[model samples]
Target: MKKQTKKGAAASRDERRMQQVFHALSAPPRRAILKYLAASSLTAGEISSRFDMAKPSVSQHLTILKTAGLVSRDKRGQYVHYALVKQTVETALMGLLTDLGAMPPAAEDKPLAEQDPSSPTAGRARKSGVATETDLPPAEKPAPAQMSMF
Candidate 1:
């Protein structure tokens, strides 16, 4: 029981971390900025050229990205050059995906649901009151003749 409590606490901490990572990524402009940095570093002007948004609005997106540690900015001459922090971004996203039930899914040790074969399509299938993936029929391959008919 004590070990279970500790495990629960650890899981909660991990969930919170994953939430922060995903929350940072949920914004559209910030995602676009990351895409622009994928090829190479770009100046604020270069990034702005791709969108109709004002420079200051784009700058706000950059600030959000920096807060998430997804980008790094260097002042070169009169322009600030922004570059992708690829490793950090990838690590954070992958970590979040792993933490949110990807580590060990319901794939193992779960009892399968019982299904009624007489039920109509999209009918609920259950086994011991639980649904299993097999409740659905396998996908139908289109007939070659039918393909030609279309």
Candidate 2:
């Protein structure tokens, strides 16, 4: 049926996105970049200055992150500011866990925004009215080195 075909196509797209997210997170530099962006959005130069690697290397990592839907880039004048796309990362991880049977499947009857108010999806739906981390000034202090991924 046409409906089944559409569902299959969507599933294939999701699978590809999951693969991209896992691949982007596989690199140490990319992980570090995520940590930095977690604190605040930063320009490519700002991110590169924090690492010993050249700007092009950092840019390459950024490109991968962008392609993976892990990060978003906003061009402000001559500089491009990069910020973490938390929802995409969270969704990918949750989907992976669900696939691996590490977590139960989410309720599919209700749209995410209409589900639990405390859920990430609901939070994102309310983002326009909320003051998120990206709305704050860039943190001068680095992300705590001891922060755990889990």
Candidate 3:
């Protein structure tokens, strides 16, 4: 086995941390907690109050968020205030978007249709007087059939 260098160890840790962040973000409750923390720091109780779930449940979600490095907690005498690690979340999200090629090109670049007519997306543009699915009315449901017991 090769010896692990400090940089290698750090990279491994970072990869694990990113995995944890993705896992933590997978749940709706945890995402909601992150959204709340994004606006302002709140105590566990304050955070719990926003959801219908039990305080412990909310706390569990907060714990996951905290473990992912997406949130940070500060103790102030009696209460522990939780806040979003905005930079980390933003960095992770931007990296994901970049990886997925979801970011639009700069203004200097032409639109896909204009740049390449042979591209599949270029030919998909709606022609004039065409009735697409959205233009049609909703289909009506049929009436239930009468049942007779013999």
Candidate 4:
């Protein structure tokens, strides 16, 4: 049926878009760039200065991000400024979470740790009586070695 064909076409387009977004997100540098842009827009030179990578490499990552609709570039006189397109990134992430049946809980709903006992935080909660806010475990110091003069 024509309806089925149209639906299939739309799905294919969506799949391609998802692939592009994920591919752009696959690299650590690219993710870091996104994090920087999330705070504020910056010129390409400013972005390159934040990392040790070559300018060309940063530019390539920016190109991929632009293609994925995660970022946009605007020309301010001679400089080109890059900024995060938050809506597009958020939509892709939210769609993926919905597909996985793990969309984050609404404020009115039970928190994720409480709702899913198998979650990592759930186990920690059981052991400690509540989930700890810190991401890292407490560090222990090494004992000092005793020194003796021969």
Best of the candidates, TM-score:
2
Model 2 score (lDDT): 0.81
lDDT of 4 by residue, 1-150 (tens): 445688899999988998999999999999999999988999999999999989999999999999999999999999999999876776687677767777753411333235466555566655544344541234533455899998
Error of 4 at 78 (Å): 0.9
Provide the global lDDT of candidate 1 against the true structure. Answer: 0.69
- Once fitted onto the true fold, the runs of candidate 2 whose alpha carbons sit more than 4 angstroms away are 1-4, 107-150
RMSD (CA, angstroms), candidate 1: 13.0
Q: Point out the worst 10-residue segment of candidate 3 by lDDT.
A: 106-115
lDDT of each: 0.69, 0.81, 0.73, 0.80
Find the 10 residues in a row with the least total lDDT in model 2: 107-116
The pairs that clash in candidate 3 are: none
lDDT of 2 at 55: 90
Model 1 error, position 50 (Å)? 0.9
Clashing pairs in 4: none
Q: Supply every candidate's count of residue pairs whose N, Cα or C atoms clash at under 3 angstroms.
A: 4, 0, 0, 0
TM-score order of candidates, best first? Answer: 2, 4, 3, 1
Q: Any idea how many clashes model 4 has?
A: 0
